[model samples]
Target: MLMRPFWHRRTGRPAHPAAGAPGRPPRGVFPRMGTMTVLPPQIRQQPVERAFHGHVFSDPYEWMRDKDSPEVLAHLAAENEYAESATAHLAELRETIFGEIKDRTQETDLSVPSRRGGWWYFARTVEGGAHQVFCRVPAVSTGDVIADWTPPVVEPGTPMTGEQVLLDANAEAAEHEFYSLGSFDVSEDGELLAWAEDVTGDERFTLRVRDLTTGALLADEIPGTFYGSFLSPDARAVYYTVVDESWRPHQLRRHELGTPLAEDVVVHEETDPGLWLGAGLSADRRWIVVEAMCSEFSEQLIQPVADPSAPLQVVLPRTDRVLYEAEPLLLDGREQILLTHDHDAPNSRISLMDPADLGRPVAEVALRDVVPASDTVRVNGCAVTATHLVVSVRADTTLRVRLLPLAGLGTAAQADPVEPAFAEELYTASVSAAEHDAPVLRLSYTSFTTPPRVYDVFVAGATGDDAALPAEPLLRREATVLGGYDPADYAVERDWATAADGTRIPVSLVRRADLDPAAPAPVLQYAYGSYEHSTDPAFSVSRLSLLDRGVVWAVAHVRGGGELGRTWYEHGKKLHKTNTFTDYVAVTEHLAARPDVDERRILVMGGSAGGLLVGAVLNLAPERYCGALAAVPFVDPLTSILDPSLPLTALEWEEWGNPIEDAHVYRYMRDYSPYENVRALPYPPVLAVTSLNDTRVLYVEPAKWVAALREASTSGEPVLLRCEMAGGHGGASGRYSQWKDTAWEYAWVLDRMGLAGA
Candidate 1:
């Protein structure tokens, strides 16, 4: 989804006549603009010629790729200084927006507790705290009836009786400049805790073990490990993965307690550079699943938790263009595997397979179809329990959960689907958490206007006797909205935009209900058309500031996302990636045509792969928008994909075809690469946000992009780069710092939309 850099030299003629003659700006020259302290930073160009697919292309701002160079750092700092000076007048607006967000959000809040093992676990955030504190209380008894999900109403600063703090992120983060909790898991006995932390933003975490009984940390420390670590059922061994040179998780290792790091055994090693390896415990806790997968292909291996040193048994061999996930399940006195795969079904289907047949030396296993895939519905995943089977499916770009009786699973019997009832059509309801043996399922529901609500769905009859039984709602916990908030004050609607290919693109919009549709207003549209990640309609407290100010917020459910189904994603990836850009442009045009939206004040924002979306669209139709915000954008796909040494490049080849091997992919990528397509045109105001420590999408992308825009754009509109010196791809580590960043971005958007006073 994003890129890296390489070099060459060109003399005589410039790469693009529109980019101006490649040269350098005087170091000490600071041009003054009206009410601005200084002009934007002018980066010097070092010509780099790259020959690919029998075509030679010249890159001027390739010098920015040297992130460690003093000049590059100075240029980034200078750009930040210029950005601050350019938006100096919006200081009060930023503070006002920040205040509104702070006032509307509950400073001290506790999440709804979910029962796991013998404890009810939840996370609490205190006012002025940088991170959440994970806490749990011992369950009063092990009973079939679900306990109350509603958390006790405790004072802001008071602690609940019998509450034990599992992990205080604030305390852990106090010593590090940047702290990110990658994984936190408690042993089955609940005596030991294993957590991973990334001090830098590189994502390589350090695994640490803590003795919960003594509140003391163990001497075991694993450095340069990846995200999750699964503790053995016996709590004697921990399984973790480590990344390769290109940052792909390649090796799954097992570390025994009180053993040296050198003694750790390699449980599994993925030789394929494209596939990533990971391990996780099954919901039933009977098996440990090791998955090696790329974007299109996946292979799963399972080993019994009772034998930590046992050989892994393959569920199914990896097949090209076929992706499937296997989870262990217990059904009808047998060990079965619940497989959600898109082998023949485009949207995917759920199948049940016996573990005894999984060891057959065959290319594929004959599985019994449970939930057959349809053209309209996409089977997302399934949560299996001893009592019921919860299937999560997406239809019409909305999520819903279906509960099916697990009794007689091995027999050829079908049960009616138990769907959750909701008042809004464009809302999301999902099985948030469920114990493998518990009859109650923790469900989460939310919409564009409604805050998140947690509920315990009690299944009265999990047997065939009561097939029409309804889910009993035991307890509900609605998120606290500090300010006087009402769902009636806002409205959410779904509209369709006809793309150039005659495909209907879904658009979700939210705004104040009182706003007149006939009157023109600023519209902020966001989208991420990559990674099959769905941008569902979810409530946001900070978004209220924009809605209350008469700004309409919308999400363009463009192609390459899982919003609609797998077909939608297939039509917008690799060779068909251009559809993603055209679809977004079509959505922009559709919104502009609406009488309620101001065509001149349209703002586009996205990050990471979505950042690539905004960047590509900005180049495609610069005149359609007033401003664009690209946060950690993957704008240099050509360079990154061309070099396999870069992080995520090889792993992402399936998403964006392997350019190094295919001439077609190389040329196609070169055609739309944002940095390569920069021209001397009247571009709109653009803000590029990046993090210095971001390994996913290197900060060099936005850095070089901003420089190129400054050198090429004739629009006088400011092209600014804001680099977080000590942050990662997601930006700031602390909540307060993240809020401040949001406020700053909101201020920029408001000022551009002529709503600074609002």
Candidate 2:
């Protein structure tokens, strides 16, 4: 899991929510509307002045940073109670929404099995299970290897022969309130299994080994490890990373199977605090790649898996503003490195380098251009198999896959591209899984109105210009909608909204097909415009509750997202980051102007970096939305970016400029930092959700933000904060808890729109 460094710090004895009168509000009346069941929390102000770049600023709620303080805990508890009382009238609605979600989801379902190392691996969930059971079955020898792409049909509640349960997450989480599996890997020989788990909401995980044959745990345990860990090719050792004081993964260490924690050897130590380190095995399973990277640039080192003690070979040196990834491929019976780099190409291009020239400097290496950079296309990712090179690209704000032959490479003419066919224009399709040695490609497809579908495409080894092979449908799970549900009853469409600078921002809309165009419908708009992360249209069973009730759902494909291309992301990040907020506001205004949408009943929602988007938009255009929902929001960017002691702050300097070192960046951030820019104006109702153990975006950010909003906002509309005591950046560890959280949020939105009964 790649945690996004969005940007937060805290002070003061937090104020408790004021006690309510003796009587409660009417059955159907919302407390915040007029009949207040409880007074809003009054956070005490203990201003702390700080000088940065010769400018002075005050943070009144800085004392909230003391998580150990009893006062802080009491304040958080008080806020939770207040939020619950404020929305108590929506309890019935929340239950209804949760029921809808539970009814529509296929509770007892099995994922399509993917073969690896002579085993078909998959995860299955029981009807009432909170977690999935990771399992595998020995693969049988088949004459046609490509045909094995069709997964075995394991009926619900039935066990397959020779089935092996790798790790039952439900059992592991039975004793802990919050449980997360950081990483899990089986040894090449399939005798040993390595897994890391985080019992607390904190990101730190404990690594442990298990004997598959005996189903016994090893005494060797490594604590405070990061998310990813790799099993050595020979299964004698495991490579893992540990976080520095600021919670950045700065060291890669190798732990032998039977060795003590003190005896673990440091494989690589990253000196640059701004770059994070991660390790993984190559697709060929012959080499281990240790990569050091920031948002802008990356450097890779490769060591042969066969010789774990060998010195790492540098694939590329760090270059300013240049990013690239290396993939190992065997071309012409020799090892070659496929490089996807942005060297003189904004959209990036794929090149090949000789592995034999390991001692040569990157600049002196003979690089062969394989996939030329295109002005209209942006290459998202690529994978190399024995015979084909599969590339994932984005064009016209839509995802597409292209397969090219890699048999002859430099000497042979280029082959025709093979693209997977999709039924809808606004759907998403990508290579979900693939075996490096197999010709079968496991592709996944989903749209707003369709559940996820898996397909297997077999390449016939065609290298020349010819018609591409058709994909074979493997499996499609019909989501169990208890009351009766049909995708044909819904409609999904794409539209455009012109930004302030005349840039056309793409927007996807989903609603009931029978929705009346003349009637005003309350809309829920979502956007996540950061880190080049594309927000594709995907099916959500819970969303049916809103769509079925005439509520319109929309996604603003604003700049800063990778939907359109790399250029689109470039235009919305760094100095031009405000474009993301403006683009989202533009989309909101456009949607509000439509005859089918009620301008005063629109809601905006986002999380993480998207939380920053929603916060900034709320400040930029306060009157446009009826309500705003921000989850784990990064509202205090200037303060967080200035503090190098905070987790992920140093690594995030590339995304958000280093305000500590540059006065210009400091002033630029001050202009748009949501917390700093909050005004005493009439604002709409707002709800902020955060987690105490969130390492990426500190919970203090939202805590401070809500306090500031309550003090500054002129509008009497409610501003509430809900803090999850045992959750991390992603709230609620179990499926049931997550559904309940979603229901709570949806109920809030419905209540704010005055459609609680709907």
Candidate 3:
């Protein structure tokens, strides 16, 4: 499928909302009236700044570390009418839009690897904390039903209540708490069982064995878990990973059946476990792979069972920028294909690497090359054998599934490995992949705007496959797991918005289609003009509420982000970092010129490094935006980067430039440091959200920003604060807890925009 332009171009069709807000939109989606004037630059740039010498930013850094610029009050005062008009209608907007996707029954929880008798199973919690397991066992040799297991009923719904059938009263205490359960492995002869369970949610796990003949526990509690869930491959030995204070994997231990606890010790301890780890076992029980993560991407290391201590070898290592999933191939000759990032671009690439070679002798194949101008290439799925390797690569909006030769994982692979005619098509974000009983590849496809369909096809290996599993229909009566929204629901319109120097900048617009084209609809915009992280087009369902409302949404894919790939990212980083701040402003002006979006209704938002994006954008476009939200923002940029002792502080030097060691880098970061640049003025009403546990984006940064914004902003609009007590950089750990926190920020924004209504 060819990719279409983001905007209405070749189609020559008007982009309109198929459905508006739950309630009436403000004054309909049409252009409204408002007069605008280009203002002078906020920061008084001195001519001496051209040297990149002395204090980096023109603003006071050390003396007024906790202060703000008060001139923002005078700046915002110039655009008073747009703010007042938006405030009048925010209440109604909130009441109408908040309820669309907020309901307990409508919520969902996801975790895979379920337990059942044969192939396929459903793992989920029932009413009252009961754990149910549904399995899809083939009935009558052909009729495979994904139905109930315990009750043995063939209904449209999934199966559950496994404890009742798989175990008796002796095994299951009257009110037994089934802490954990699963189908460990089916075995070569397809007999016997080895599953695991942990009474607690922590890493403590027990490997249990049951006779496919009698279905009973083979041994006592699989001892105490050393680090993570104990894994039992075949009934021979159990393998597991252990984590220390920093949650780093350190050891991989093994235990044989009938062996005394004393001697059955750790078969291997990853020497550089701090930088690497492994636990997943191969189907043939000949290999094991562990994943390792660092400041950058993580790599997977594999060890042969015969030489379990073979020097740490990489199966899928982060060589470039992207992280690839090295899925274990369950064929006669077990192997793995590496998912890698493009070395020269922002896209992702897929290659095959043999786990045997300590990753020294490499075999890399580019599944999808980087699209010259676009940042959209990701590998999805692959099935490898001794003779062939079937791969799934996602680019743009489509998934192309191809079959390559098994030798691709080795230097011996044939030159032309891909089968042109056999390649199949699947939609991106819709398909789900899972291994069946044999070498059958299951393809599950669904779309936010489409229903789900599953396909089980026979992928040829060294030994030819004669029968392919029939395509099955996955009837999901309800709307798909996808939302009727996409990142494209928001538009990117680059235009010239002049700065104090008369330099025009670019801005991206992301708003609901049915908005008043000229009414200055409440807008929530985001940007991150630092680090080479490319903020390309990506889907996120959590942001739909803002887009659903008449409020407009935008992301300033400024210079810092690698949206344009490596070169774009490199240009904005290092000494040229200020371009990030300026690029963010250019985006604001482009969107502000759109009639439906009121300049006064504009709101700036960003987090972490992006927090800096919002902070700078708010100050630069102070007269345009009504409010600002800097989440765990990097306010004290220069100071934070200079302190190597802090966690992530040292790692960010490569991103912000090693200011501590290099004076030139120091001046570059100092120039746009959000905390240092807070001028004395009435700044926009900002809610600075930070987290104490966020080591990446320090809590002090946002805390200082909030304090400064309060002093600088002349507007009585609330400059508030919300600091997550226990959560990490992400803010929330649990699914429900995440939504709760997000709702608070969203509710506040809607109310502030005068959209919160009855």
Candidate 4:
């Protein structure tokens, strides 16, 4: 298996020194590094504005069309130069940091023969980059040599290592830049091979099958506008989903394994406008299920797909009460389906669905919320068995994946309830990785106090039930630098800040415990609170830099996220979108209330959608913060969503609502649209960063937003624009590079908060 390493500051672990860490904390406290650094005067001159009229919607980039405008060309040229510099600087920085880490590390990843049966063809990462080559892991755990792996095979008398092969493959893939291998499927009989890969992160994929025995290409190429492609159980067809022109979700399609690609087929479709698309196929490929999670309700349907275009029977109709989660599994010695769902009540349950009666699953099995962690809710899917399930549940920051029986669950079911398989632990087990011996061994690791590790686990049944899972951890790095640094060294607690509407928003604050409670240090607060996603507890390296420097770091778990469950998300989005920005503002205000932390010491940071929150706040309370770091931000909400021609504009209407067609939604988006609200106001130091190749929240959004703010804001708070020339919506592809980028971004923010190098 390709090994990847991560560096982080864990909350509840022992710390080791760095490869060459120099000094220790003063009096056991990290001294601030910005004792001599100073903020630029231009930052204090930025202006602030709360609202802008509709006429402000005119495209700010229209000036660029005037080629004769030397001003525009000069600006563009400078930006292009800056982009190049960012990449160059990142490469250098990553090399320095990773080199230090590598010196103190042993294994980056390992190749182990796990209990899971899904280990025939595995992948291994090459040495130089974030690329990997496919290889079949030896059937035995190279035990003491567990850290060592037999690289990929090429040809006779060839000594090329896996990394070398992957380097060439990555180079080859770069040539096309449009298609490469994703997941390759070798038939059960080991005679056929099917592979799928897209243009990087975009959902569209290409599926090509080859005769493994003869090393000959078999099926004609199939192009998809969506994700999730797998070979059918019979091995006669390839099935996957497609995104239509309108960006609407379509059904599972089947293509013939032989040449002359089969006709495009739709296995199922949900026509309800109220219901957005959510469909999945069973693991064994016997049934295809369709479901959608609406603003206030959800529904699901299942069908057997012998013929890809065949209509599916109604399974679980639309309902606000019961939420059905799809699980891919084999049951009754056949390809069946297991599910994780919540009933009309708040509780969650598991169910057994037969492939034959997918339209309506008769067996509704309710498992006890055994070892239940209240906030612990499983992510979207389930690990299935003929009649049981292994589930990963989460409550707050703690998570667990347990096994539950299918019979006698909730309704009239006969299956038994399994025991709580695993207890709460740190870091989510790394993506359900590694399978062997009919038992799927999942490597999941997290840090309660130290960096994460790779844990090998056996799914009691679905993936395979190999008890006494042979456990092998992939890699570990010494956090010796953190040995003297303790979470208790700083005071950590939760407090509530009241919003403008008297809504109480909870904020988690961490700072030097010895500092007087009345002393308000430069506080750095982060918030997300949208997309039903929670910014819960996880190990953070940059946060350590803050704590080390005596800067207070806090997390505002405001509404609009599933943090507090579905209700929290619903309360902050939809007609309540304003609640999100408002809640964030409340947290900032509360943190700034301390005497030690002055207005000039407070700064806010967020990325992507969270970028929207920070932008809105800068407009809402522009004077309250000393600086704002919005990375890969989504600022042009109003305009980006109106133009359907834009990549995700049409599809996003479901998330942000269609303002063009619905005046109500339009007004809502307009009220909070950061781009539209940008006015001639003095602002704090604003650093706008983005990735040039980002498909989501196009780089154009930040570029245009920065330009507008530059032309409008009175506060010169250096409206710096830093764009990554070769990255995607994910920021960067390399681990070391990502860490350096984060460190630099944090370093800059520290400078703004008068905490630079401090």
Worst window of 10 by summed lDDT in candidate 4: 1-10
Candidate 1, 1-758: lDDT as tens digits: 00001100000001111110123121111122227657777677779998877888788877788878998889889988988998888899889888888887887988877777777788889998979999988776523243333334444567778889999999989988889888898998999999999988878899999999999999999999987787888899888999888988899999998999999999999999888788888878888888888767678899898887799998877744457778887776777888888878999888888777775533456778888879999988787777787888998789999888887664567677788778798988888887776656888988999889887776756434344444466446788887678888778889999998799999999988877666677789999988777888788888888888878898999999889898888988999999999999999999989887877778899999888888899889988887889999999888888889888778889889988889998888888888889898777888999999898899999888888888889777788899898888889788888888899998888766766665
- Residue pairs clashing in model 2 are 10-62, 10-63, 11-61, 11-62, 11-63, 11-64, 12-63
List clash counts for every candidate, in order. Answer: 1, 7, 60, 65
Candidate 1 local lDDT, residue 248: 86
**Per-residue lDDT of model 4, residues 410-473, tens digit only:** 3445444333333333234434543212333344544423434434333443334234334433
In Å, residue 413's CA in model 3 sits off its true spot by: 9.1
**Residue 666 error, candidate 1, Å:** 1.1
Candidate 1 lDDT trough over 10 residues, lowest sum: 2-11
Clashing pairs for model 1 are: 4-640
In order, the Cα lDDT scores of the candidates are 0.81, 0.81, 0.49, 0.55
TM-score of each: 0.93, 0.94, 0.62, 0.74
Deviation from native of the Cα of residue 155 in model 2, angstroms:
1.2
Best by TM-score: 2
TM-score of 3: 0.62
lDDT by residue (tens digit), candidate 2, 109-129: 888788876788899899878
After superposing candidate 1 on the true structure, give the runs of residues whose Cα lies further than 4 Å from its correct spot.
1-34, 142-155, 359-364, 461-470
How are the candidates ranked when ordered by TM-score, highest leading? Answer: 2, 1, 4, 3
Q: Rank the candidates by lDDT, best first.
A: 2, 1, 4, 3
